[model samples]
Target chain A: MMVVIWGVVKFIVLLVLLSVYVLFMTWFDRKVIARMQNRVGPKLIGFHGLWQPLADTIKSFWKEDSIPRGSYRFLFWLAPIIFTTCAFAISFVVPFAPPIKIAGGVLHFSVVNINVAVLFVFAFLGLASFGVLFAGIASGGSKYPYIGSQREGAQMISYEIILALTLLNPILMSQSLNFETIVAAQTHHLWYAFYQPVAFVCYLIAMFAVSAKVPFDLPEAESEICCGYFVEYSGMKMGLFPFAQYIVLLVMSAIMVLMFLGGWTGPFWSGGFIAGFIWYWVKVAFFVFLFTWAWGTLPRYRYDQLMDIGWKILLPISVLNIFWTGFALSAHLPFF
Target chain B: MTQIVFFILSLGTIIGALGTILCKNAYYSAMWMISTFVSMAGLFVMLNAPFVAMLQIIVYAGAIAILILFVMMLMDRRVLNNKERFNPQYFWGIILGVGLFSDLAVLAFKFRINITNAGKSLTLHGSNTKMVGDVLFKHYLFPFEIIAIILLIALIGAIVLTKKDEEEAR
Candidate 1:
């Protein structure tokens, strides 16, 4: 019963948080890109276009949802829901703030504090690619979406290995699979990032690739594929894809904070729930801003280049990082 | 209640196993396989092996399913049209599968395995995870190290197989 109730509450909270994050991510992307281009962006809706995302959301809700004729109607409808649900579910084990006291004095941080939190996150994120593949096949588009889906599938599989191996560094250091316990371990010493900088770099690169962010967004390279897997979607149906993207970003950032940056272990201002929440959000926002900056600076990679980087560069580096981390741990190094 | 949950999960596993054999499309077959893995994981949890259950979900359902999907993506779509060759073999496979399943069912029903009434609480001190870790590092350390070495060799072999052959040819 507690599990069911907590699952429901977490679902609602994630839905609301993801919606708000998607809204602001749009605003941030547009505003940042516009500033780069030396032009104004969405200054009409409210003060400096603060309400622009809200307006856009309302407009999308009212727009007609179209299904292309002869498409696989069932998979088409099921794709986004499956994708978004998996993306949202990855947050169940991710601790956002320190444990908070509820009405009955019961303490909880995450919805599901399972032992294998890190593995669960990667597994769910990997499942999310199905949404893209199914959407592409269901679109009844020519060969482009199929090709795009293939590319996306391959890219995700390649990077997922690196992502898992990179995370193994911290898991090895902490010697625990629970996200909260990992964070608690970091508090006793220095952050994992300090000792495992190479792993951190590999993790950051893999995160971008897994999330399909800039330089690795070849799946939906606008110039080539014209929205790729979601070419046929419009209005609210199309909106769910970006919404899932925002949720992925949020979840990945939260994982990074927990695994590497010492989640909820910042300098104490008041040493309460509010302080922990503030620090958590601050770290997440900083990473999100870094992603935004990446979007503005980097050009998308070619398909072969992306694969080469994953298989050749990132995978080797991550393996080496694991060895280095193990050696350091055994040597009783003062780095962390 | 536990019996009801086990019955439902076993039913799901059987249905999904049948679906994997019966489905025409390879993608659909993969999805059914995933469903079977998930249901099997549920059975693992019911047997008080949460770590094993989670591993079932993570490694098999997650990683292996995705790998199969990748293989499916690489296959020629025209191969899916060759249904005539698959029908006979699929029938035989299902017959053998059901026969094995029933034998296992009979064995499971006959045997009464004793589960020690230890490590039932959720305390962090002596949970299954801690015990498993301790046993793994202490008693089974050499085998664990051997497994790591084997995995490393497999990784290198994969890299070599997938590498370009131009330099070797020269």
Candidate 2:
């Protein structure tokens, strides 16, 4: 019973932390993008628009709720719910810091640490695409939204292969799927990124594609499909799509850090939980910033170019990298 | 708690399967099928096969269902609604259903249905993912390679079939 209570408490804390992170991340994204474009963004609200996301949330709540005619009302209501749930579900397995020794037992920073956590994260990612598909299908049989969902489905399938293959390099080297084990393995040797540079680069590129950020944001291409699957969504229903997206960005960034960046362990010193917690977030923040940075700098890839990059380039390279990593590990090659 | 979870998942699986068949819309049918897949994954997890459960979600609910949904999107609703109620395929469906039911019935009656340590050999010391990896790469290496080769052949065949002819392209 105590254990259950502790688990619930930890989950609530994580929820609060995630909400705060998302709120600030929106501000950070806007500010960074604005600076890149040589303009000030949301400066009037709080300190550099720190409170703007909160204001936006309140405003969205007050807006009139509208459902399109001929829409599947039940599914239209359920789509964002599914998306947001799956998005938050990915974070459940990501360890924020190393487990800390307490009075009676150890306390893990993550919500849950299942054995097949790597696969679990990817599974949720796959399931989240369903939410996008449902939104498109439930939107009164609209052409644009349907096209957007189709693009999302294709993009997800293409990039997921690359994402899985790239991450397999680290998993192979570590010989474990658990985040804690992977991070622990890194502590003993150099980070996987230093050895598996190919996988790291591929993962970085695939990360942008999987998260549907700029360059690969073809699913939600503003000019082309007009915000894609969520074109018919309005009010908080609309808000939920980006809400889920920001969480995905944070979770993917966290996974990248955990897998490749030697999660929570500082380069100079492997410190206590307090220091490790700070180190972990700092790394995660860099990746989060990188997402917005890419958003600001890069132009959207044409649909054909997106497919070409995912299939023709990234897929072959990642598959080869996996084979190379496996051979190197077995051969006891130096720096593996 | 375990019983409650099992009951919920089992109920969900039944409802999803029923919905898949009963839904008039192809899109809703696909969604219901996905729900069934997810519930089955939960059941797999309860059976201590987390790896298989995750694979089920990733492969079936994620990839295959999306492909089915895409195909269904191109289909006209008028054509779908105009379809005959009864079909010749029902004969095959009944045969398959009865065969599966009898197989399950025989297993239940003969084996007494207690299945502890059913997958012990496949999951010894390490987690099931590791055990599965060891089995695939070490014990069943040749079969694994053969499967990979078959998949590669299929992939190539798909490309060949889909590719535009040179004369048509010109």
Candidate 3:
């Protein structure tokens, strides 16, 4: 069937494009961060350090794979494999832009736009925590990684709830779990960010925490835990975590754009497929660039402080934001 | 194509469930259980209930399995030495498991519900999520409220138990 063939082709294309995007992101991130820090990053490999990630990838992938002694062989293998799978799977539902009309047929940019895309997104994001938990626990009984995994588990457990709560803002407004409908809602109304600023702020903080960016990167804090969960890992095994994190960053940025930033819709180019794709790509790029700037600027959060922020602060604000959004909507005010 | 996906997912779930028990190491058992949960989610998705699929993964695999793994992590590694592979109850356990499986198999075939035309039968409005909410809020409202009450009670009980543990630790 044409549908089946198209599905297979789309899967293959998504996989290749995802890898290429992740690889290039390494250089993109380093260069942007370098600019933030007033230094040149990876200029030798190619123009303005474009091919730096390609060189980095080749070196990391070809290096020897070794498992430390006393490691549980099965789990040592399982962690990174599942971690990367979950990370890549999260990108499947992210739409590049709104649907475009081509030859009088509508084309959805997402790989699969399911009925309950919101829940699907939350589920996979939650699943990533298990990979971190197992990776730390299976590190040959290392005390350091065990501690790191515990913190990782605790942080994800706390933040995932807040993230789920914050997601309700757009879900409430659109009353649909489908990403396409949510974007359509945004296109009709103002971006949710302008309407639900409280929820938006809470979600922004939780998003960084979820992706383990700086200020929330305590799980694998290089200075303190000395690589934490992947401390004993080397070569591609070690490099895979960063690769997965890059994918997570992309997914998170894409979701924020879709949910809050009026995905694929900008001025002067409102409704065309290619134009919407371009607009979506531009917004996502801007988000990634902003994230790198934050990564370069912020200090990592202390462990207890991270927990406090997730539970004590963001959790309550997010829960209250739901009520606030509901009240505002009920009032039917100009802002609402 | 649907049959192929269902076959693959069902086989995976069965294999994972068996592996969960067969694997002597606690950590591997937890991993197998998680995989089983994932396969179950795939089955839910195949059934065209995406919300249930998400909950299956999020609640069972993400939360429950992670909790089990946390306990597995704290355990002394030597205690899992698989010295005695089988317990004395093994014979009865197999018999009971087989008995349950056969009963379920018969019931599964007998009670088909034939959900292919259920949506048409109801002629409900809106998306699947909306239909689910409408049914839960209108027809099954009492049971839904009861479930919520039960869950809240369970949560409070857990908090109390943990608070007790803290006091005893102090």
Candidate 4:
């Protein structure tokens, strides 16, 4: 009975924590990016701009909700929901920390501890592209939006192949797709990054492209495409797209840390929820910082150049990484 | 709680499937197709086959639907909607679809009635991903290899068909 109550409490707590984290991250990004460009971010709104994200949310809520004439009503309404859902869905299987043992029960770190967590992550990542596709095509015959959605769709599909292939390197090495098991495998063995550096690099590149971050954000080239597929969206509807994007950024970092950088484990890490959670999130934060740094520093890739790298460069490297991992295992190699 | 989830997902799946055919715009139809695929993935999760569910969404909903959406976008949008949503074959199509559904229903009920237990029974024996991989590699290796060979031929055929001759281009 207490366990059931704990489960409910945990779910609510996690949901609230995620939302608060999202809020803080918006502020953090603004501050970081501003410092990068020698300007103040949002310090005027509150102490260290703590309430800026909340204020922005309220402002967006009051903006005019306009739908393009001749727009397909169902799809226009559904796109943001799908996008948000897809972003949050992949986090369901991700274990947050070590399972904490209570008086009568155990508290697992994830919402759903499914056996196929890795596959689940990739699947939802793929599905999320449809939200971009629908948003583009259902925008009442907008030309630029159409172009944007096409690019988003093409880029997602192309990068996904390499993403899955590179993912298999860790999966093949660990011999499990379950995140919990994978983490445990890394707990015993060294971190996957040390063992499979090629896979790590391939995955890192694929991750940027798949998430449509800077240097790979061809779908929404704001200057040329006027923000691409999401041009027609306005108000809080527009708000949801970026919210979903932020959530995905957080989730992707967590996944990267989990798969390659040793999930929830650090030097001399003992079994305690607080310590494990801190280590896990600290690593996740480092990766998120890397993403933002790249976003601030890098220029967007040209269209053909993006596709060329995805297919010609990343594809071959990812495939060879798999083969290398396989050979290493078969030869009973001593080193990582 | 499980029953409620099942009800919602099944309703969504049915509506999505119908919406694909019923929508006037081709873009809407493709979007509905994605909805259907996503709902099917949810059902797969309920059935304890997360691997199959994920694969289903990734391939059908994500990749293929996007390809269709791209094609739909390329064509003139003005002609995508039909003046009359119903076609001459609509009646026959419904009849045939219902007949096929009923036939499958009959077969399933006849064969699997004894195995039926709870109204919402979902069973699983082992690791769904591992089991699938093992079966394909062990039991279905020959058929899988043959299919791979056929896919290779199709790839070659596609290149040959789409190739442009240098003389013709000049």
Against the true two-chain complex, what DockQ does each candidate achieve?
0.43, 0.75, 0.64, 0.75
State each candidate's clash count.
Answer: 0, 0, 0, 0
Local lDDT at A133 for model 1? 78
Off by more than 4 A, model 1: A101-106, A267-270, B1-4, B85-87, B90-95, B108-127, B144-170
- Candidate 4 C-alpha error for residue A307, in Å: 0.5
lDDT digits (tens) for residues A1-336 of candidate 2: 887887788889988998888888888888898999999988887877788999999999999998999888888998999999999899888887789888998888888878899999999999999899899989988888888988989999999999999999999888889999899899998888899899999999999988898978988999898899999998899999988999999889999999999998888766788788889989998998898988999889999999999899989999888888879989999877
Which one wins by TM-score: 1 or 4? 4
Best by lDDT: 2
Error of 3 at B83 (Å): 8.8
TM-score: which candidate is best? 2
Clashing pairs in 2: none
Each prediction's TM-score against the native? 0.88, 0.94, 0.91, 0.92
Candidate number achieving the greatest DockQ relative to the actual structure: 2
TM-score of chain B of each: 0.75, 0.82, 0.76, 0.82
**lDDT of model 1 at residue A48?**
93
Task: Show the colliding residue pairs in model 4.
Answer: none
True contacts kept of 4: 0.82
Which is the better candidate, 1 or 4, if ranked by DockQ? 4
Per DockQ, what order, best first? 2, 4, 3, 1
Mind sharing the TM-score for model 3?
A: 0.91
1 against 4, candidate with superior lDDT: 4
